[model samples]
Target: MLYPNSSSFTPTPFTLNGIPGLEALHAWLSLPFCSMYVIAMVGNCGLMYLICREEALHQPMYFFLSVLSSTDLVLCSCTVPRMLFLFWFNLREIDFSTCLIQMFFVHTFTVMESEVLMLMALDRYVAICYPLRYSTILTNPVIVKAGLVTFLRGAVLVIPFTFLTKRLPFCQSHVIPHTYCDHMSVAKISCGNIKINTIYGLTVAILIGGFDIFCISASYTAILRAVMSLSSAEAQYKAFSTCTAHISAIVVSYVPAFFTIFTHRFGGHTIPHHVHIIIANVYLLLPPTVNPIIYGVKTKQIREVVVRLLGGKRGY
Candidate 1:
């Protein structure tokens, strides 16, 4: 007759402390996100199809592009679908284990995307700066090695950080503020020691993200210097043209990522939650959506292939 039930109660589902205008804002935003996601998936899939079908584009550059499209596809799949679901259904409560998994893959693909961009930049540098040696230098084996290195680097670097995050205890409020489960946001809710996890997160930002950005910047600088030294205007123009798509993609990818990271680190509740949410969406979804469009529009060959594919379908 002693109260046994008092000691054995299950925890209630975690509810989100959504901001005042969050529902309205989320509703408004979901329309564009859904559109962007559809367009992004189509564009990326189309690029992959065109690249794989066209044997003429089976060189190192297009090979890298195919790989990039694949990565962007994965990156978009990781974050955008869940975000859309949360926006539409108001389903914010995530299982602890599932949240951790989402955080891990999101970080993994983000790092991999950065490495891919760096590789693309290096490929551009070689193609323009050393056209004679480009074929010899950027062989299949070399491209394979570059890809392997990128995969290994991203995989290895994120393990320690993710492991550190998993080890932390989350006995406190389990409600994560953000729409999707992110590392730092989830980490902040833990009741146990989080200093180590926070430090590890920062370490990852500096080591993996910062390092790749530095390398990409250096590669472009060298490419620009080499481009300037070339006497022929046509040659410089051609070389610069080759880089337009990549540069656009890089800016779209990096700027929002940096902004999101900076805001997460410094901005408090004083900053509008809507602003934070917008930045998060931009960081997660914009690159995938924009990259394919940039490449398709900037590269005439890709455009022609897409047009031909459409025309063939229409004729049939």
Candidate 2:
């Protein structure tokens, strides 16, 4: 479904090829897809609300978690509503400019999410490896500055990368083989030399996301070393325990994501288009839908607040 045409082109509206070969099953598919989006919206929203309401969650780790929740909400928002509509009502027509804008937000938010995760890892590293200086290092203004820098970094890079369409021609079928517009999916449709596009995209992926992953890994290595050096078993357990939610979040966010990426980069014509699209959807859907559950189950403070909130509702 990565359609790179062999001829010259003209600009036109694009029809999203929503779940090809699965058109007959769209009605059935919409149910779970809609459910996931709803859960994602509510779960992420609830987490943000709880963090804002509970004064105890104002620490650097929780602040990063809140940023992650916001990113997840926006990322899901970029695709899910339209995706649901595409599945159920078949509203797949998207004009060129709008497509570029949507692609900008989607990619930017994704970059922001990855940055926030790395920051969270750094926060954990500092807390574990150098606890006494955690407050001095990650004060309120520092967290705010980190967020602004993250947003600007993603915005600056992704906008230029996405707007690469202005230089190419689109004489091909306006049918994109994915639910929502992606940078590569959109770029590959152009009838011009796409070598530049592909190279730039891969560079952005490697530099932004790949580099962040390396930093996160290094941070965790330091955290583990510091944790192991603690003489008290209880101290070691406590330090490691703080990272349980973050580790769960990383797993849920990255595992399906890498699978989706592999399908895009290497699956070629051999893999089913619907499988690629579904896996892509899953990669985006799971984090927002499941992260709140992970933190709720892992973080004692979050679990306590959630329990109290539910119990209060029951009393009503």
Candidate 3:
């Protein structure tokens, strides 16, 4: 049960717990993060430009890639810039309301990205399993509906979770150990019993991440079975090739997610501070940086389009 009367709980003003000589460490970390942020932004922007400009790439798969790239760009922008600023100035304090807003956007985009992947898996399933009807099945109207559903799902699911987090009475230390205000990290500051918040978060994780992963796996399994029965070697090869990028993306996206969730729930504060920082950053930043590279390697047309759009002479 949630504790009522949280309005009376006075939160301590947040202050920076600056470690001595930490300026050097902050600089060391900021350099790499800034580089990664630049690469991720350029790569995703390039993907979006290619898809938008190239008429040949107007199909549903590339359409989904464009959406995913746009979402990644937003997600990266939401988290990384603030983190870089914090590290550069050693400003460790954030207003409570600002922290809540940041958490909302981070979780919202995270869910939206997961939904886009699920849509991508479904697109591949239709293309492979129902080749004759693929185009008709994935018409623009249908893709727009899928996008709407993804957006609404993220918005509706995250609203309640954010409210639940906000209602928690924070009467203890306000220093969030990690760079940003993660759900678990913020919940830790609440002086009241956090059973409700923890349970709600776990439930959302299972429903959002777990259910999406399960659906994607089921779609791909059906896809693999259909590919196996195809008599043509070329068809089988093509089918398998389409999935390689998505498979890599799924692995990269989920591993760090599960690691952070598991550590937050089970590891408690026993884990070292540095380890938590690493896992937190990986969960927030890795997908945006790696996803474009995965698509570039697996989808030749996208790579060609990206190259041409970047003013390089390349043909698919």
Q: What is the TM-score of each candidate against the true structure?
A: 0.90, 0.93, 0.91
lDDT by residue for model 1 (175-247), tens: 7777676788767776656788777777888787778888889989999999888899998888789899999
Compared with the true structure, model 2 gives a TM-score of 0.93
lDDT of 1: 0.79
Q: Write the per-residue lDDT of candidate 3 for residues 221-308, one digit (tens) a residue.
A: 9999999999999989988898899888888888888888878888866976677666778777888898888899788888776666
Order by TM-score, highest first: 2, 3, 1
* Global CA lDDT computed for model 2: 0.84
lDDT of candidate 2 at residue 163, scale 0 to 100:
57
lDDT of 3 at 246: 85
Candidate 3 stretches with Cα past 4 Å from truth are 1-5, 8-24, 307-316
RMSD of 1: 4.5
Lowest lDDT 10-mer window, candidate 3? Answer: 12-21
Q: What local lDDT score does residue 200 receive in model 1, on the 0 to 100 scale? A: 76
TM-score of 1: 0.90
Q: Which residue pairs in candidate 1 have backbone atoms (N, alpha carbon, C) closer than 3 angstroms, thus clashing? A: none
Q: What pairs collide in candidate 2?
A: 9-171
Instruction: Name the better of 2 and 3 by TM-score.
Output: 2
lDDT of 2 by residue, 1-316 (tens): 3444422354557888888789889889889888998998899899999999989877888888889999999999989889888888889899877888888998898888888889999999998888899899888899899999999999998887665765667875678888898877877776667777777877787787688899889998998899899999999998899898988888887787777766666785888888888888888888899998899899988998888889999999
lDDT of each candidate versus the true structure: 0.79, 0.84, 0.82
